[model samples]
Target: MNKIAIVYGSSTGATEAVAEKLQSALGDADLFNAESVNIDDLKPYDFLIFGASTTGIGDLQDDWEMLLPKMEKMDFSGKKVALFSLGDSASFSTSFAGAMYHLYKALKGKVEIVGSVSADGYNFDESDAIVDGHFVGLALDEDNEYNETDKRIAVWVENLKQYLN
Candidate 1:
């Protein structure tokens, strides 16, 4: 069976819910909470979907801090990587999707950008769309005053399902 891993960090279970939904949608998936996961156990997976809930002024969740240094030092060549982030745009306007931005830059390898989502909004730039793959973003709740954020995510994820099949 093809192995896909969903490694995540969640504070209020919002990100966890998102991850579970994605995992169920994918089928044949392994879900791991970042806090209890060991790096060595990750070797069995062929693809990775990494998610983190933003904390402490646009930073990674507390449990994820220890793994950053380790992830920075390892190699992910020839691996498929998808990134998702949970954050409050209202609190940190400047760094709305900081965790995903930083992780994408740090991980070394042939990463196919799966995309990033936030509580603010996302871009559906025709130029940014990936033909053979998909880029997506989704909000955790309807708290976004403008209400445009969640709509974009739904659209993006619907587009993403095409590639998954």
Candidate 2:
């Protein structure tokens, strides 16, 4: 079985682009769009990577918002999940990648979510996604700092391999 499942919800394709890149970088994970994802599609993988874009004032994007209740109900006890968020840090510094906060909450005690990235390189003023001194997952400012995404993903994937293998 593949070790990871990279799922994403995107309104304007930014998050999907990141998902694609993550699959390319990892080279061995399954990618699923949030709109059509089902438990069966996820059952084979022990690791999951969820990606979504932050919407108005830090709200979760539509497809991911709709998927939350279902995700919360799943038995993810033995699974490890990660998150990647896409938001405009420059325009919404106060709420950069904040929607990831909800996703993290839904899976917190249920799943062993991994890949908490350090908050060091981000230029945002604040983020709901921040837990203590780190992001809940790999946070990406694709709308504002697109150039950094490649480096960020490469580093995150490298760190992620430690958990996967």
Candidate 3:
């Protein structure tokens, strides 16, 4: 029984969609809306998948903002964790990928870094996703610009699945 948690902060449902897809790929997973998540709930899961959307100039979306302060104060100790971020590269100069920065910083020592999903080509760190350069679900609008970036997200989740199994 590989218990995993998929927690996410999404404004327009984009990030949530990605999170759900990741969950499907990874097998059975507990899903949480960031606003309702308590850090204490993490106790049961062996692995965690944190998802967030970019908002207001590279800042984490509102839901994640509420959870971050609390999550930062807690300890993940023996947890295995990964991150996935959703954002439009054009809107924020720093981009949606920046959302993973803080969470990774806070949970670094407490958990093992398994993977990360970033539109701007983030190194997956301790995982094979980086070595394979596996990126799918990269959605784009009619103009060929990243309006959604879904393919890249799918690849990101699939890569993270490697860690879960």
Candidate 4:
């Protein structure tokens, strides 16, 4: 079984809720707050899932900002990484889930990025999170489509399992 680690930076608890749901869905996974986890600690995990809530106009959550530089310096050569993020798609439609894109950029060449979710069901005007016409990871709009979060997470987690092996 792949050793998985879920690390998140949440300001309003929405992202944390999704992280907890993922932990429940993926049995035996470990969870960590981005502020408290050391970058070196991630080296042991076979798979890394990062969750963050986008703030301002496409900026990463505050805690993620501090940890990102450290993450960039770490070697993720044999690991697979997936990302999830919370954003207000209704209000911030243009830059929805931008933080995930930022994180993707930081780790792109270093890790084998996995779980790119389709953008078909999302209602966004534009997003940095989109690459090759798909969201770089699971994109959640808890502010507007809160009711869909659980289902979305369940599906994304299932999809992620395929990439882990």
Candidate 5:
């Protein structure tokens, strides 16, 4: 099994909760808070799962904003990456899960990006995370549909397991 690390940035703890669930689901994975993670801490991991909650007007969560420049500079050539984000589609329809897009743009050409989820069940006006009719990562609308989060995460993680292998 590959060494996996789940790193996340959360303001209201939604993304962190998801990360915890992922850590539990993926048995041997490590979990880290984005604010405290050092670049060197990620070197041992072959796979990375990043989670964040979208903030004001399509912005990444505060911790992610601080880490973006470092992430952009890091070499992710042989690493595999997956992304997930928490957003409110009902309130922020135009920018739902936008932080995931920011992460995707930073890591796209550098890493083997995985975990693109279907956008079929999502009701959003617009999102930069959408590519070729699919979401670039797992999208969670906890504010509007909290009940669906667990199911969505479970399904997405299962799909991600295939990609990770």
Candidate 6:
């Protein structure tokens, strides 16, 4: 079985671009769009990578909002999930990458979620995405910190290798 699956919802293509980059960096993972994915299609994968973008006051990207309800019904027992989020921290400082929180909330106990990052090095004021002292997952602020996206992805992917392998 292909152990890794990347499921993402991107309305403006920015998140899709990152998802694509992640797939390339990881070297072995399948990509699926939230708009077209169903639970059966995801059943074979042991690890899932979710890419969600924050939009309109920290709302999940349109496609993800539609997918969450269905996800609640799927069996995540024993599976692993990671998340990557896109948000403009300068504009939504109060809720930067807040979409990651929603994703984490949905899958918290159901799956062995990995890839939490320290809350330091980011300039945002607050984010529900932070749980205990770290962001729920990889948080990318390409709008203001475009230069760091690649490095962040590389580091996050390196960390995830321990789990995926």
The models' CA-based lDDT, in order, is: 0.59, 0.88, 0.62, 0.91, 0.89, 0.90
User: Model 5: what TM-score?
Assistant: 0.96
Q: Residue 126, candidate 2: how far off, in angstroms?
A: 0.9
In candidate 6, which residue pairs clash? Answer: none
True lDDT of residue 78, candidate 2: 70
Score candidate 5 by lDDT: 0.89
Off by over 4 Å in 2: none
- TM-score, model 1 to reference: 0.69
TM-scores for every candidate against the unseen true structure: 0.69, 0.96, 0.73, 0.96, 0.96, 0.96
Provide the lDDT at 98 for model 3: 54
Residue-level lDDT of model 2, residues 1-165, one tens digit each, is 437899899999989989999999999988898898986788878899998999989888899998888876687767888888888988999999988888998888888888999998789898999998999999998777889999999999999887786
Candidate 1 vs candidate 5, lDDT winner:
5
Ordered by lDDT, highest first, the candidates read 4, 6, 5, 2, 3, 1
lDDT of 5 by residue, 36-86 (tens): 999889998889999899999988999999998898678786789999999
> How many pairs collide in each candidate, listed in order?
0, 0, 9, 0, 0, 0
How accurate locally is residue 33 in candidate 5, as Cα lDDT from 0 to 100?
95
For residues 1-165, could you state the per-residue lDDT of candidate 6 as single tens digits?
338999999988889899999999999889999999987999999899998999878778889999988988798876889988999999999989999888999888888889999877889998888999999999998789989999999999999988876
Per-residue lDDT, model 2, residue 66, is 88
Model 4: pairs clashing at backbone N, Cα or C within 3 Å: none
Candidate 5 residue-wise lDDT at 27: 76
lDDT tens digits by residue: candidate 4, 1-165: 889999999998989988998899988799999989998888899999999999999889999999999876787877899998899999999999899998999988888899999998888899999999999999999899988888998899889888666
**RMSD to the hidden true structure, all candidates:** 5.6, 1.2, 5.9, 1.0, 1.1, 1.2
Report residue 47 deviation for candidate 5 (angstroms).
0.5
Query: Which residue ranges in model 1 land beyond 4 Å of their true spot?
Result: 73-75, 108-112, 116-165
